[model samples]
Target: MKKIKIEPMELNAVKRVYLLGIGGIGMSAIARYYLHYGVPVAGYDRVSSDITQTLEAAGANIHYTDSVGAIPTAFLNREETLVIYTPAIPANHSELEYFRSNGFVLMKRAQVLGLLSSNYKTLAVAGTHGKTTTSTLLAHLLATSMGCDAFLGGISRNYSSNLILADQGKQLLVVEADEYDRSFLTLHPYLAIVTSVDADHLDIYGTYDAVLNAFQEFVSQIKPGGYLVVKQNIAFKPTVGKGVGVITYGFTPDCHYYPTNISIHDGLYRFTLVTPQGSINNLTLGVPGHYNLENAIAASAAALTLGVPTEKLAHGLESFRGVQRRFDVRYRGTKIIYIDDYAHHPSEIEALVRSVREVFPNRKITGIFQPHLYSRTRDFAGEFAAALDKLDKPIITEIYPARELPIEGVTSETIVKLMSNSNAQVVPKAELINWLKCNNVDILLTIGAGDIDRMISEIVNTLEAKENKAINE
Candidate 1:
């Protein structure tokens, strides 16, 4: 792919910048970006969290309250300050409304990211499931090889940070392209990879076909002469225009890039990677998930296409620790093993459950899942139930209800009722820790996309202490 000159967007020089919803993953990355550049940044979140506190510690003037009056005085200057917000913020948010009423220049997070990426050699990874890990791995490969910068959806266990900024000019920019709100359409990337087009976000998309259409639109925005790496079995056909080459990748033979000679030894997966240039054998991943092998293949293929050698790809893959909350292992012992993952969608949940079953076939798997959104619980209740029913024993928790208002008659009870497993029960999040303390688990797993992650440490401690006491007795 020939690199085209990216005309830089004019950035306003400001003394103080106000972020209306600085707590979002994407918004926080941008906040870090500006703060790293010595820009004075401050913001308000509806609640305080570890992420918000980290931003606060990093010199961002952060407040949990939503009052417009709480905004710093310096950011109130209409002429010099810019207000950035996320689409997740309610339409009637006081701070957002105040910024608009007061003549402040305001922009969505996507628009700002698009403007920033437009000035760089952007490599955008868009998908339903694997965008975070794939983009983070790609960034790791690029940053470790050719100097690069990245904006990631999750904190990299390697960097211990979500935002990876390079001091040098934008030789490469890796971004996790978010499909929510169709934010990825804003990026005109020199390289793009779509891992999956599974039916998701029905609240916004309404149908599977609409979800595919949004992906097609994302492909159209890819710069001409660039490459599009798509997962092999997606329903949509690539309608990329002339000069853009479509490459398919999967476990299948017809894929332009595929994995071969796959094997797992002592929980480590080794595979032979076949690219157009040649094949590399015995490639190992630092992460343990069998599904991650395919993710690594996609990332490595993109890296190889961008001129990274196979050896460097292998080295980077070996060193890649993985993004936080994606099959993150909190505790591992001889008798009791605890794994916590961020798997909200049914497909993701099934994958996590299946992988755990594969790793420990003999042990009885007890999974505790917290449903994420009310819309999703209402939409895919049957699917979620079917997936959770696969485990030996499953416990369903009340829905997290992130952004959407709770729907009438829609709750985790809906999913639990549909499950065939008699063990599946709707448990409150508050009682989870106490329940874990009494329960005897052979292989314990907590899967969710919400605040279930906040309970990981307590769950791990409880399980570990139980195991220790059992061993001593």
Candidate 2:
């Protein structure tokens, strides 16, 4: 890979920007940032999604096809237009090829983020999982108090957007440092938080040790005099340069920052945040789940390190509504409760199941999981099965292959057959709602990081209709 240096002042010279996959969450956030800065933006996506429509509504020119002819004439100027593309896009994409051949400066989305980080005091949140929620909450906390700009991985419920703009004088920026493709290495953070360093994206790293080594490299990228806050019990050790501070946060007392005297009341988690500086007592997180409590602690620690006062931090934590699909509760009724999450990894699945069980111990939990990628399912089939088996009933659906082709002999049955639960079975996505109608589902969890979310509204409507019929009867 060629190393190109982009200075902060050079960004002002670019008259327009184009994105190859503009509808993606991270890409859209970057697009929104440029749009806010008065830069003309146009892009192409494989399909028109809600995010694409929102960007279009906000003055971005977007197209659904990959053809070079669809490119806006104004963006064809190679010198004035900067092209940003997601790593997920295929190399053969016509729009990307056109830009490359035409001498337009093409950059990965991570590189753009790195350039932006240089202009502001960046607080980067990175990990295999938990980074999305932790970063979103940390952004909310800092934005609520001191005010900051943010590019989040997920749409924050509190802000109702992934891109949080700062006031005119605000110089702080919060970013979700994605570990995939080793993208987080590009960032030089003033404050960095690693929530977990679990082995994931093996297709990219090819080994668990490589993942750890990448994280170690990420930790090394923290700027001098910056702070590094990590979750307790994560395997990777920090190799920060001099003047960098390291702190750990989790549920246990050994962590520098932890929660004490935890309790759940009315579906909310209340705890005391015990940090090295001081303790914030009776802090109540607006979101549910045990894993979320840990996330809140990590976010709080990062915020506190940045000089957010204890009172503002506590209020921000309580006011946070959480990110969409992290632990989104679609419906809660006496007959049935339905929740949806974007948990594709086995460790994330295990956390979801354990949190759900902790919240509703007596409820008969039924889980419908669609594996996200062929590579992930093929790699962690047994782990996925074991995680889903924690539920009372497990329903595995066909894999949602985001980029990779289907692996031979690896299907939903691969997980179903390995599940220890006798009630486990493989079901097609089309039949899921119908199956839900016939089954006795006390607590329903729809889990995955793919098109499984497309089925949520239908499932909710069916469940509501069923509940109405029972009420009338």
Q: Which is the leading candidate under TM-score?
A: 2
Candidate 2 structure quality by residue, lDDT tens digits, 1-473: 11223543265558888999999999999999888777899999888877899999999999997788889899998878889999989988878887888888888999999987777889999988899999999999988999998999999999889999853455888999999999998899999999888878999999999999999999998989999998877897778989999998887889999988899998899888888877889899999988899889889998888888999998999999999999999998868999999999999999999998888888899999999888899899899988999999899888998878888998999888887899999899988888988877889999998888877789999999889988999
Model 1, global lDDT = 0.85
Error of 1 at 265 (Å): 2.0
lDDT of 2 at 68: 85
Q: For model 2, name the residue pairs that clash.
A: none
lDDT of each: 0.85, 0.89
Off by over 4 Å in 1: 1-12, 167-170
Model 2 weakest lDDT span, ten residues long: 1-10
lDDT of 1 at 6: 17
> What's the true lDDT of residue 313 in model 2?
90
Candidate 1 lDDT for residue 73 = 86
How well does candidate 2 score on lDDT at residue 266?
85
- The reply for model 2, stretches above 4 Å from the true place, is 1-9, 167-170
